[model samples]
Target: MDHNINTKTEEETITSTSIHQESKLLGSNKSSYKQILAIGGGKGGVGKTLVTANFAITLARAGAKVTLVDLDLGGANLHTCLGVEMSSRTLSDVFSSDIENIEDLCAPTIVPNLQLISGAHDSLNAANLPHAQKQKLIQRLQQLKSDYVILDLGAGTSFNTLDFFIAADVGILVVLPEPTSIENAYRFIKSAFYRKLKNIEHQLDARELVDKIVEKKEELGIKTPADLLSAIENESSDLGGKVRLAMNEMNLKLVVNQTRTGTDAEIGFGVKNVCKKYFGINVDYLGNLEYDSAVWQSVRRRKPLAVEFPTNPLVATMQKMVGHIVAEQAEKIKNEKSYE
Candidate 1:
């Protein structure tokens, strides 16, 4: 009897150790995936959500586990855009109730390897979510398990939008070729940069100078980012040094939409030149989408452009964009692993 008891105890101990070792291995694997991208623009009606949805779908179709989050709390129509109706739960439901785990709110979409975390649709409270709540939402988003997490942010330079954009691995700013959209896109980029500076305000004097530039632009219509940077440089050499470093570290991408001519296609290049010349920022030109009836048709059908019109020109543009984005992310991951 004593011999049998000893054998059983030894077997149980070995099993427990093996289970612990397996758990550690699984945890380590989970830690490897942390890429996130946020799509936003300063102006409205620039097809931000549509681009995000289609990009998420394309990535998922390519065997990636993608999560498309509708962060446009003011008008959360991403579910409608994706042709998904009556989600049993949403982000609001998770935040406002006892459901603390975000996975409970994740709704499976029609696409395999793709999931949708619908925003707070038609909810007044969602539009007015406090900064703390927005921060909490971002923290939860980081914990999500996926190869790519794309956030479709609301328009304008609201703190909510900037916070989400800054949290992302890639900040994609979408704009049309129209003058109004281009102007607003620049303002959005400046606001986003200042917001980032504020977050690291304690580490450098650049934050103070950037904030001053933002204030002057708002109050006096400085109009040119280069002029503002020059003024700051003249004020203090230390501030200028920090500003250059901040610009060097910026990871912002530009995407031009609704191109009608070669001139329209060159809008992205112009924007890139402006950012580099004035703000000393490097903006990646991720390509453009031509004006197509299929885009509007897909919207009317309540499906993503890529899904409804996979062979359209717009879809091709998006496919190329997604390929570049994926390659960039893979390179980043490889570099990180090499360093480790």
Candidate 2:
């Protein structure tokens, strides 16, 4: 994909920020200070792990400490992607008495400021991780000392995946330019949005209301989250307002990978628009990764694209996306402080 494309330039507004201040604020001892970025997709082989590994490298190279967590569960290979030997101290160790802290599993990588917590030692049923264990893992991840934590999530909309995706400060969904991929991407978003709503339905005292609305959404003419909120408002405006706030608070992003053409690169914007219209969610299109044979060559060499092919055009695109993410995150922090 040509980054020089006029359309690409018009679509992306890359922002700049001070990495020193970002590191100072985000790398604090407080777990809440850490920034969590979860990369997931509905279908497999959409380059989720590739994005996670490269993005972590980009951040680390930018002077921020980064950790890559292989939450892909039963099928973990992030270690292989980064050319790191699989460590004995994997996430599976956490389930046993031998390991008490998640940080104890951190393994160094070729990159200076990047660490990894591999999931390679997990059991076949690791994908079906117990809820309590998953929650504990998420908390520990937040408590990690790294300035940035990138989760390489498993494909599908399993409850575990949805919960982890929702737990992150930023949720990014990877998609390909095809019908099947697009459909699954939509399914993943819908599942995640409802999962979030379900978690807070009890708090809003609208469990039955939400269930009824979703069940009869077709009959009730509710097509989007906004439509459902309008229906709830008819019954109780206060509950509707709270639910609306929850919806607005969702931070999600879009990235189209393996783009072979300009139309493929444009898929991100199309997905973003569909999401806004169908789910009433604002998904930031974080640019695209053009299809490159070098990606596969790097994989065969067991190295991250950024490290193996430093001059690759795809690396430049990845850098642009990371810049936008950092700038937006910094702005978010500034806005929150003003409110405080």
Task: Specify the highest-TM-score model's number.
Answer: 2
Over the stretch 141-202, how does candidate 2's per-residue lDDT look in tens digits?
A: 88788879999999999998899998898898899898999899899988988888888797
Task: Tell me each candidate's TM-score.
Answer: 0.81, 0.90
Clashing pairs in 2: none
Candidate 2 local distance difference test against the native: 0.81
Clashing pairs for predicted structure model 1, backbone only = none
Model 2: what TM-score? 0.90
Instruction: Indicate the worst ten consecutive residues by lDDT in candidate 1.
Output: 1-10
